[model samples]
Target: MRKTITRIMIPVVLACVFLAGCGTLAPNYTRSAPPVPVSWPEGPAYPATALPAASPVLSEMAWRDFFSDEKLKALIGLALENNRDLRVAALNIERARAQYRIQRAELFPSVGASGEGSVSRLSESLSPAGKGETIDQYGVGVGLSSYELDFFGRVRSLKGRALEEFFATEEARRSAQITLVSEVARGYLVLAADRERLALARQTLTSHQATHDLTRRRFDVGVASALEVRQAQTSVDSTRVDIARYTGLVAEDENALSFLAGTSLRAELLPDAPVNSVTLLDEIPAGVPSEVLQRRPDILAAEHRLKGANANIGAARAAFFPRIALTASAGFASDDLLDLFGSGTGTWAFAPRIDIPIFTAGSLRARLKTSKIDREISLARYEGAIQSAFREVADALAQRGTVNDQLTAQQSLVEAAADSYRLSEARFSKGIDSFLNVLDSQRSLYGAQQNLISIRLFRLNNLVTLYRVLGGGAV
Candidate 1:
């Protein structure tokens, strides 16, 4: 008996050793190169040394520190707490974690207990001579039913895949968080810009009203023509129309801000100041471009997805080989309930089963092929995500430089236009120029001021974009 048992166990042990040597089970997935151009266009030249030596990288700063306004920080905090989209993303992470737990459980043996009772009459034709006519059956068992030994590392690979998927979901949540922070910041900046424009419009309306009153006095004294008085009236009326339009815009922006913050608080509750009052770093410090692969949440999520896809290939390949399962049970049962636990009524069972895939009409092969194709697709998508991220960073950097230059130019134009309007007014008052010149000067000044506000807003928005593209702050 011992020799027979050793003969059987030796082959089983050798088989296990052979399967263990198969190695890794899953295909290796190397990081793919990004599809975007490695080098971006150099931003407009600026004095590199002009930036403060102590200035920190934008990504190194916490968002709360970067946005110093107490109200704005509170709003962001509320959004993070109550935003529906962020809550959904967080729920998905929980779901992924649960799935990972389920997959990991497969790597271990499962134990269970079961019991049954029945009474039956034996057929006369099947019964032996002198046998009882009726028989009672009872069973109770503790069992390990159909436990698979993962000598080929199949379960391990699957667990690895699930873990990667869990991480991927976590990264996805982080990506959503980054996007939310940027959105709130952008909206806040827009509100500030609109408020500034409204203030400017009101100021212009007051100045135009004064001019209209002066023209009316001159006309009553027979010193100005009716046409000059009419022009002044038109200017005042147009300015009033702009004020109404901007007032509506400001209300709309406040509503938007309230929605983004997940609250009913009015814009008045926010700080009433221009975004430029918050100091942004003079220069954006870019880390190594390759570091983006690790830092960017979306890119990391994509890579994890790729890893999952690769693991699936191994699981599919496993289907082509035989599956082995071991089952065992030990228990006691007796016809009399009182004797159910008696040693004489004890029972046990053991089974080792093997299922070979002899013929599947190419199904297994096709599944394996499909898995490989999916892995390829995931790899491509991962590469694409990286490329997209790189482009976003490059685009933000380029826009920042361009917008700054544009703002500077627009400021000079606004100053020049203001001076021209002053000279035109003085000339008209001295009776050296026509009212037509004054009207033209006033219109030009209004246009220049509007343009300047737009440029300032663009510059501020570019900074927001840069912060977002860099995956938000360290928080």
Candidate 2:
């Protein structure tokens, strides 16, 4: 009899394995392509310089290759290692991976081993033979208990949800990393620009101070009026105030950079001067907006979440179907522990269960509806992410085209202002012009120089922004 049972069970178990390969009931997953221009907008909004025919793949370029500054490269490395947000993002990926594994495990049966011993005393009144008796039983077994038969793909759907979530988290981590790199570079550029501005302020203050002293001496000799001296003093005092303001700004910039770095940064790693030149691989073939936006980590993460939502809909739908579960065991049993594994002491049991939903007061229907709604919500979010990314890239490109022209025009303005200031100063000293003319030229030159520095910083920082928006960092 035992041999006959074993033969029957072998095929049953094998059948279960073979039939478990049924296809999932989940809705087919199809990516919704974002609606965007085939290429970056041409014409005035996009500068001609911003459009490249073909260039190195932006996503594959290493951050090191994109940022040529040694100090900036070191700062970005430090931030990637120590930033708390990035660490959290990375840890989330691991957690999601573990969750995915746990859900996937539900698709398979878990077999385990067990050993048991039991003793019972029976009273005379309750004994079948009308005599008191003590009985002992020992058993060893291997079995699978209450394992679901996923004929409707419920488990598969859940596993798919877990998988998509895992992918989403991984992409989120990548997004965090890209943002961190951009932030570090921006902070460093601000610090450099502030330093240069601070230097310019000090130089202006010194020149104005000398002019004020010379005017005071000329006034004492009755060769210059008190008005001229006061004008010179006003310029000196205003420049002194600018110097103090810039000093504070430079300090604040350093603090911001350190916070992003996740640790106290060495002075050597800080930019000593304002960023006059930014070395970056700014030229990239602005492929169709869809192609570029698809590579963005945030956009990818959103799409994964959308996929997960679709999987959840499958799980909810499967809930409306019947569920089947199986429990089985084969073991050795005997009244004495010594005989538990002896010949002819074998035992076996099989149980199968089915649960068909009779009534749920509309719970199943409501759940299915909720899952579908969630999927729609995810779809909207995915589309929104693509739109946001498209806008960012467009804005960056718009700035990229005109920045060089702005820089060039600013340099020319500065040169013209400097010449005007020099001529006015000479004329005032020679008694051919009022001190007011010198003051006006001085103001103009000072403003022009400040504007020049600002434009230069913008150009450098814009390159960083463009790189980030294009998803150019990290291979």
Candidate 3:
């Protein structure tokens, strides 16, 4: 009996050794495509002239430090804590973590306990006895039934995919965070620009009103004509119209800011102050272009997804091979519950199973092909993301130069218009020019001023866009 048992055990052990030597049950999948070139034509080259010398490349500066306004900081903090989108992102992270845990646990065995009882009565006619009899039986058992040994590394590969997925989800959450910060900052900037415009409109209205009153007095004294008074009235009315328009714009921007901050009540409570005026840094610190792959959350997420796709291809190919499973159980069972734990009632078992796939109606090959195709799709997407990122950064860099030039030109125009308006007003007071000339100058000046404000706002907004394109927020 001992020799017979040895013979069976030896063959089983040798089979396990042979299977182990078969290496990974999964096929090795060569990457369908080469890695995307990190250096694209649109990528920022070293020593870019557009980069400002003093502009610090956006780092993971706490939003509070970057914003600096106490109120804005408080608002951002509140949003981070309460934003619905952020909350959803956080929950997704938790879900991914749970999935990873589940996958990791599959590498371990499962244990269980069970108990059962039954009573039956049989007819005496079926037995040697001529009377009916009842028998009661009870049994209890604690055992580990089946546990797969990952000799072929299938479980390990699954765990690796799960880990990658977890990291990818984290990257997604970070991307959400970066977007949230940029959106809030941009909205706040819009509110500030609108407020500035509204203030300018009101100031213009007051000046026009004074001019109108002066013209009316002159006309009553026979020094100014009806035409002069009418022109002054027109200027005042137009300025009032501008004031109304800007007032509406301010209200709308405020509402937008409130929505972005995630609290309507807090938005209403914002301080009435212009956006903090800060000089644009002459130079911006731009790290190496390759660093973008590491710093940008979306890029990182894409890379992880690609990795997952590669792993899935391996898993798919593995399905065509044989699967091995080992199972063992040790327990106590007896007809009498009182004897369940007795030496005679002890029982145990061990089993090793191998399932070889001989045929599957072409399904296995089809699945493997599908997985390969999906990996190729993921590779393409990854390359596309890199190209898109490069283009965005390059576009932002190109815009910086153009926006700065526009701002400078607009400033000169505003100054020239102011000078022209002053001269026209003096000439009209001396009766050397018609009121129409004064009105024209005033209109030109107002338009120029408004344009300058818009340019300034655009420059600031472009700066925000540049930062975002460079993957500045949330690290």
Runs in model 3 deviating more than 4 A are 1-61, 123-131, 215-234, 264-271, 276-283, 473-475
TM-score of each: 0.88, 0.91, 0.85
lDDT leader: 2
Rank the candidate models, highest lDDT first.
Answer: 2, 1, 3
Candidate with the larger TM-score of 1 and 2: 2
lDDT of 1 by residue, 1-475 (tens): 9999789767876787688667546877777666765555463532121224565756667888766667767778888888888999999999999999999898777999999999889877788865658777788889998888777777777888899999999999988988888788777777777888888889998889899899999999999999999999999999888889888988888887777777787545664876466444445655546755567889889999999999988888777766778999999889877689987999989998777799999999999899899998988899888888887877776676577778888889889989999999999999999988988888899989888878777777777776777766777
lDDT of each: 0.80, 0.87, 0.73
Candidate 3, 1-475: lDDT as tens digits: 9999788767766766666555444445443332444443343332353434555556554445456556656666767777889889999999999999999888888777777888888888975688898867766666655566665666766776787799999988988887787777677777777888888888889888988999899889998889889888888888888788888987887777667667774544464665436222334444546766567788878878777777776667667655667777767767777777877887777887777699899999898788778777877887777778877766666776577778889889999999999999999778798888888988898899888878887877777776677776543
Runs of candidate 1 exceeding 4 Å displacement = 1-17, 21-23, 35-40, 43-60, 117-138, 266-268
Candidate number achieving the greatest TM-score relative to the actual structure: 2
Quote the positional error of residue 78 for candidate 2 in Å.
Answer: 1.7
Q: What is the lDDT of candidate 3?
A: 0.73
Q: lDDT per residue, candidate 2, 51-170, as tens digits?
A: 354566678789898888888999999999899999999999999999999999988899999999999999999999999999998999999999999977899999999999999999
